[model samples]
Target: MKHTARPSLLLGIALLMCACSQQPDRPPKEAASPVVVAPAPQTPVDEVQRLLARAARSDPATANDLRLDAATELADRGDTVRARELLASIEGARLEGPQWVRHQVLLARIDIEDAAPATALARLDNPAMQTESAGITRATQVDLALVRADALQALNRPVESARERSLIQAWMSDEQQRRANARAILATLSQVDMGELGHEIGSATSDDWRGWLELASIWRDLRPGPNAQRAELQNWQQRNALIPSLEPAYRELAPEILERIKQPRRIALLLPLGGAAGAGAHAVLHGYLAEHYRQLQAGESAPPFAVIDTTSTEGGFPAAYNAAVSDGAELVIGPLLKEDLQAFAGNLELQVPTIALNFDNENPLALPKLYQFGLDAGDEVAQLAREADNRNLHRTLLLADASPRARRQVEDFNKQWRARNGVVLDTLYLGDLNDYRVQLERTLLVAQSRERSDMLARTLGFKFESEPRRRQDLDFAVLLADPVAARSVRPLLSFLYAGDLPLWATSESNAAVAGNRSDQDLEALRFIDMPWFSSAEATLRRSIQAAGYSGAIERLVALGVDASRLQSRVGLLTWLNEAGLGGATGELSLDTQGRIHRRGQWYVFADGTASPEKARPETPDPSSTEGGTAWQPQEQAPQTRDAPPRITP
Candidate 1:
């Protein structure tokens, strides 16, 4: 919540215009001292004038009291400059109790308005204000807390601001004000990263703080759909029954979500069901239907689904999409290819709300109703670049295997890194397994260091021994490789004395085996990948695998699962810009351009196990790579699949 002053000068102008005719040439001195013209002042200008007049005629101590009232009136009117000046004229040490607390609060309010949150917080945190806090009125207490929260928010301390808001929530008497305050708390908590919020929940000592954090975490989780989110909400309520301050906000969620849960009279999956892309299309179809069936099992309402095969139609996506709309599909969830999405970019508007399965890699024209949600490699690169920037890793080294996809990823990272003014000291493409060490040594400056050491020994005319040192200017390295290449290259870098350098990688480098001793070679390497790989989502992965969906293609299945889950809640993502929908592929959030960005879970390989970064370690077997390795899907499923039924034009 925030407060602002209006045009008090205009109020003064109106007062002068009305009173000019009533005044005599020589208005009496007593009149000059001013009487209460009316029982209540007409506006903030009148109130401030009346209080200042009374202060002029009162004793020094009482005059200071009236000045405080005048300052508050000025602040309420958004005349903070005048409010601050009036407040400064009074001796702060002379005030006590409620007046003293109010004095500090008003000063902090002015500081906040001046864009100095630290100064505002410092004034509010003063010991003298706390000493007299007990004597402050309920309204004053709320004001104190509100200002403190605002300062904290301005300083980017979202969790602490949320806590402060929660503290004074009950003190708010107006029902509307209380509800707004609760929303303010939620909005602030939403600004926090989901991963950070999870950690905060674990360490939170206050029941109130933990409840708010948990609620936010629940909202950010990758659930299957609105039904799953609502279920999680119910679970949160069951877990935290005692903290009722946020009940109004929690109660407010059900109706809004329930409305979304009832939306999209029908959903259409437009895919190339009988062509080269048939298998992937069928996987998507299966995953979407899986979520639909799962919701049906839970007795939740879901829109009827219709499938239209783009490949069977002569006109392709345009014809298939028309068919879906002709069948009363309120929301269309496919045309699952980049080329199909290119058709969307050509249109000025889409007939129905469309969630395209693939993103147009070329410069895409913005469409009002087109929402792109797919497993985009660019999203991971952007996230990693941001993570590296956040860690202050300015100077970077890039290493990638010789592959077309790896080349594209490297180019994307360079663009993102350069956009941030980050320096890429060197970039190397590893061509052969035999040349891995040589490539690393040359790019890392290890060979150069060894040459320099040997040259110095020869100049000394005696054998002087010194170990070679790699370049120390680099802050981190980006490795673009698969698990196999990473396994070989990571250990070699360490042996070459560049082991201490932090490595940031993409999901491609993540191995399928968990806690495999062979993974010991990948220890401490950080990578970002789909939530499907995370152990936390093992149940969801198992459910998909149980349905005969496995291997690399499972990623597409996960994409389809998210697409189904996202159909109803797209509005939620749009409404709350910071809100994220949890999905099998990643934590999904929407951008203003109608592009959905995925933030994958971060993992660090530790002693042969790829565990969630900074989270508690899971026990690992000390045996071989095969021992204690959790069963994940192989690169390819065991059997060949049959073609799904074709959709005729």
Candidate 2:
């Protein structure tokens, strides 16, 4: 057992942010369903006085508090003109037990707020301004100190940030006063990093409505949280958002924290089971479930996988998931279609951890405790980037495609790659790639021209000698275009800059034809992909009847079975560290950040059809075997008909 000599922030830091301020449930005014005051919007001032007078006669204890609160809010909203009158109207009244002190300070703050910094500092020095020493309300001191701090900081006083921090430090040193520090600090810091702050804000322990009200208020104070103020948060918010310094440090300790949060202990898998998705889902279910079960057989506790019929049942994910929870599955998996997950995301409460088999229609969207793992074209590009990373290919050139998704994929890859260690030289979006090779050759020759280099140099305030034989600084060329693009660009790029750069492609570049195989197009596009299947799963192949191929051949069609081989490759592996039988898709595990950290079978497009490490690597033949079509994809059907037609809810 590890010795707990002191609270190790390094270990799972059991931190729960307490936000006392909550915003009212008011939708935006410009939304289709805007909450317009049809008549007109006006401050309810007279109403406040009416309520106050009634309360004063009935419950003076609450009356003073209400009046004082209204005044403070008006002041905060910049109605300082009239807010001063409201505060003055209530300043003479006796408030309940501890609220009297808050009133005085809030009243003084209006003056403190209006006065010059020097005047505010002088006011703080007044004996009358200080809370009584005998038995001061705890908040009084804090309120005074914070006001003074804000005032000083506003006017460029000598030690505002430090002095405020020091006073808070002193307050926290006192055991009794320490209770609210976490809340206060969290409130202030949340303003800076709203997204970051939200990751940890769950329900608080207090049932008191006031606590919730305060959290609402604090949350509304969306200025900047302390975390946002930190040098690290500031840096990450600008760049490298995927890897916040504090988050990584915190994430490393997440397992322990996860161990403590009981609900997400369950996971859900949503895969299409029948119809067009059956064959793929079946194989995916085979590899992923097999791997997970294999781990369980090895004594690891695997989360339960509830194989719901996501194919047929168009409308029952919610009810079915509730049934799963009733039956003991903590999380869910399988809804191999986007519509089903969308349905669940819209209507169903996230009862358990859900790992979606298909991505949402919104590109690059995240679901609450919901992650998608599917075989999209982009996954292939990411795999190539990973391989490039391993090879230390720090500089890259991108040949683009017209597909919107492809554009975003390349864009994300460049953004992430640069954040990692590389730069994308250029991405050329083109209309037709039929003459890709010739075009690439000419483009490279021109871009590499001494004259062109000299012009570019002049733009950058520098000069390069007009030497034709000199090399270019670019390292790798990424083919975001499809197999068709590969057929042209590969030979052309190589013909121009053959020895200097390595060309990359998604598994789509697999162009191996069966009989009339040609080795021309595979000249330089060497890349990596998630393994969908390999030659080793003997019995697994026998299980798949039609499109009968040997286990020796790699298969990616099976990915749709469970979710899709693509989903298993990224999402499933990300949720768990288990291995899959991704022969063609490339088998390996992934982390939540979508990093392929483990080694998977790499199939270089030699002669085409994916050739595993042991298989003979042939030169890429444009018509030999299509990288994607050469290996028959799993032909599966959807799960069922319990679901309804898809429409935006």
Candidate 3:
């Protein structure tokens, strides 16, 4: 279904690169003739920066274009305030379609990532973006499409995210068409003059392994069925092959690199063995301890685990530390809080690989050997984005509240989505929960139109696309805000649900309502979440309850336990990962940096209440538990006749 590439695409940049030097497509309209190219030894910046300095030399028009480009660069480097200053210098009214549209896209993306989706949406709300206006020209459509997609994913609509995928899919029908379409989209975007994006994709065949792998990952991640699967493997293989170049220090030096990775001999367990987190700590300990017994049962030596109370007085820490280390400990798990870490930091020597729940990135004085491995926000988003990609979701919009936390989430998600070549529609911000309906109406309707939908109507064939597809709006969104806000957004959900838009969520949506559940708008809405325990059968439940008993009665009765350990870990990790949209606890796999990659299972709400669509397996027979171990006979005790002997001898 992909339309063949137009003559305009062939005659564009690729052709220009083949012929080394080309005359100006048009003289600088500002009438400043002869732009200079610097000498050989000059830095790359020297040429680009020099012309930009005298941008205003000829006139305001040249100055505005140069200002836009400069502003975009600043924005790319995570400097919004400075970028905004440059943007203010440009007169928005003076710029034309593609240039003007590109400026709006960048400005809006910055606002969105900074948690001002409201402002970002305003910038991209140009009428030309919605329709093929006589004046807009085709060159700007793709940019508008990409930015609009970002807007949707931010809003928490995965099904609608799929629709955005459908939109991109229509641009290219088959596998080859999709890759070419992606290459085309990247090619066009490269010209938009966004600072980093320009360098994001150089010649794909060149030495730019990161760019190539990134693009290949996106393309293969999006395509579905057999062909897409094959493409995905090939692309991943290509990426793996180029890992050495992409991470020079990572792959090159042999033994030196190997030595840097400290393999723990014996890990010291520091956790709340006697407080609120005690049950959870113990439940985790059951797993860690079970790992030891299981290893020993398999004829492998069990690593000794030296457990300690993570919550300890300042005076107790040094003694406990010395004790654990003296016992051949090569690592430490907790001492969970910041106070304990700071108190012990100065006195501690680098004797073990410490796994703190807290990261020293925020605390520069953080302990030397400590590697933090708690729930990180970026790790969750990275995982969630991968899941979204696996589901073939092409377009993602991000909607976030205005806050530093929300903005950071936006930045991480943006980087991930861009890396995947997925489109971010509009990341809208919420000022007041009351304005939910009004705000969403503008977002959903303004971007979608009758004319384009009518033309693309027969084009997009998914069942969900019946009316919504014909409308140029996004079908899914990522609401990167909290649950309280989402609960308030029930009315907004009304707007979306009426349109049959499926709303997706991060872990936040599962939070208990502060007030009434009666008014909760999100209950019926479907989203993906991570459960700490993948197997939620009755047997799994009984096994976990038995593991956390504090009383004989609780231990004797499989039905009772002080707290629900399995649910707690799953629920907490679900929330934490949602803080990243990362997957489950048991599978909580991450890269060396502790970013979650392969974790969690995705659940959709098929019925009214939240339930797992897939059923979990029951516990195996005790005889068969250890990789089909032989059923052993139970030992019998000898009986005594004490009462008979006391009768009268």
Candidate 4:
């Protein structure tokens, strides 16, 4: 059969096969039209505002939630007006549980922000709002409590504020939050009057919370000694044995309580006992012993003490300090001269607590257990600036002697004055006490008055009687000079028609001795000094005199008395700067650097005698207003007196 087919037939069959194989395949199905999705709707308002608008169109309750959130943001930005408007829209809206509480809280917050704490307080006190409800979450309750506390604080109700703050612990679970709340409560309590605090604690209902607050209040007033404080704490613990909640706080405070009770058994006094510094040292010793005896007479436990004579030894302060330490001295107080103190503080490996009787102008190394206390004029100058600041006397005219010591005082005053944002109108240095009119006229700008007088005389073509007037720009004048210079300068100020201006001076303006003819000239001059110099307490003066201390040494005697008493209280003073101890020197407080500063009562010379100025009025509570900021004014810086001229042996 293959042989019978012709070539044309075979060729046709091959062509047919090729045509069938060349047929095209079907095309792939077009990708399914991509599913189109509309983009999210964008609104002009923020998310919260848009949500509120949408919810308002449908669910009013949801609308209120959004509005509350939006209002909270507005309030935070201090936009009270708009926040109030948003809050008003939710008025009468049916809300419950957290929503209701949140609404109330926000309303109160608005009141607080607007400085209407009383109004806020009234709203928060509603009994219906205070009751726990199924809708109120623990967090919402906490917010309500915090808002209430804020309102109470704003209203100046510290007791109420503290009580409200204590309630927060019942709702708060976070430890850090609880600690923060506790600090706030304690700070509020701190502002309360001590007597009032005691009264509040005493009147509180018997409860674990009240007991905790009482414990804190008692601890604050307990004796500074660790032993005394611990005893008090233990007594409180026994009384509050059932208060398991306070266990953590007590445990935390235990170590500090123990440390505060520890005290040195013996103290060593190092002073120059020979040469020019000898008399001053003796006066100090006399005062120290006088206080020791006084304390003994009062049946108080006085620590054993020893005196080492640094001037008597050839090795000076270093040998004496080493000898005293080797003799079992637990504390050292001495090296009266500034140079000796600097040398001792610098060279010695301090093993025990020390209170240097003088301060170094140089920035010396700060050693642990080292304290500096002295009769430096810098203290008085700083106090003068504070008094002026307290009196609202922003502009000051400084009149001081030209001596280096006086200049140093002026420099210190300027430093403190500048710190308080005071303006120094002028600083006049009086070279000669005999003639201060020229200096006064120049400093007070009285030359302008003289020029005016000359102009009037020239205008009228005749001389006329006239007194030059001081510049009115100055609010107060600070005079730093000795009694001799002050006596001469005071009358001159009056002669120059400046008697109307308030004049403030340091202790140096008044002669410590009574019945001075110069006292007449010191009339109306306000001054500040230690109680030992200005006090009318006969017993104190007699005790000092009985110690054979008099004249300039009398002040040194008082310093010694204060120094001896301060040894026991150094720990207390160091820990709490506001805890003032009334000593012979004045109200004493220890600065952060262990420098003791004194606050003297202001005194004014009147009717031929110096009398204490009236006590200043109590500062009004700043929280009384809607404004939450406390407005406490800065008080006088504690001052130290200047050293009298060294008496020769």
| Per-residue C-alpha lDDT of model 4 across residues 115-234, encoded as one tens digit per residue | 776677666555444342345666666766777778767666767776766655545677666656655555566545444555677778857567656655654442233344566677
Arrange candidates by lDDT, highest first: which order?
A: 1, 4, 2, 3
Model 1, range 307-404, lDDT digits (tens) per residue? 88888888888878887788899999987888888876566248999988888767664678888888888899999998887666899988888889
Compose the digit string of candidate 2's lDDT tens values, residues 403-481.
8866887877886797667887667775655565456545456445546656666686754333232145677678776
Candidate lDDT scores, in order, read 0.72, 0.45, 0.44, 0.65
Q: What's model 1's lDDT at 364?
A: 64
Model 3, range 1-649, lDDT digits (tens) per residue?
Answer: 1112321111111111212222222112232233332222336764336546767574655665676666655655666676665554453336544455456566666666676544544445444433212243334344344444455445533222222322443333345544444343332321121112223444334343344334322321211222233344445445545443222212321222123322245667766666666665565455445434433554543345677875563445556677788988876665545555565557666576555544444553434455445444555567667767656787766777777877888888889989877888778777866575556655666235434555554565421122232123454567676765655543454434332444566644544212344323454444444343234333433454566532222211211110111111222222212222111232333234432232334444322234443442332222111111112223433546542111100
Candidate 1: list runs displaced more than 4 Å. Answer: 1-158, 172-177, 191-207, 217-244, 250-253, 347-349, 402-422, 432-439, 442-467, 511-520, 546-549, 618-649
Task: Return the TM-score for candidate 3, rounded to 2 decimals.
Answer: 0.41
Model 4 segments more than 4 A misplaced: 1-263, 433-435, 445-469, 534-538, 615-649
Q: Identify the runs in model 2 with alpha carbons over 4 angstroms from their true place.
A: 1-308, 324-331, 361-371, 376-383, 386-392, 430-438, 446-471, 497-500, 511-520, 533-601, 608-649
**Candidate 1, residue 131: CA error in Å?**
7.0
Q: What's the TM for model 4? A: 0.61
Better lDDT candidate (3, 4): 4
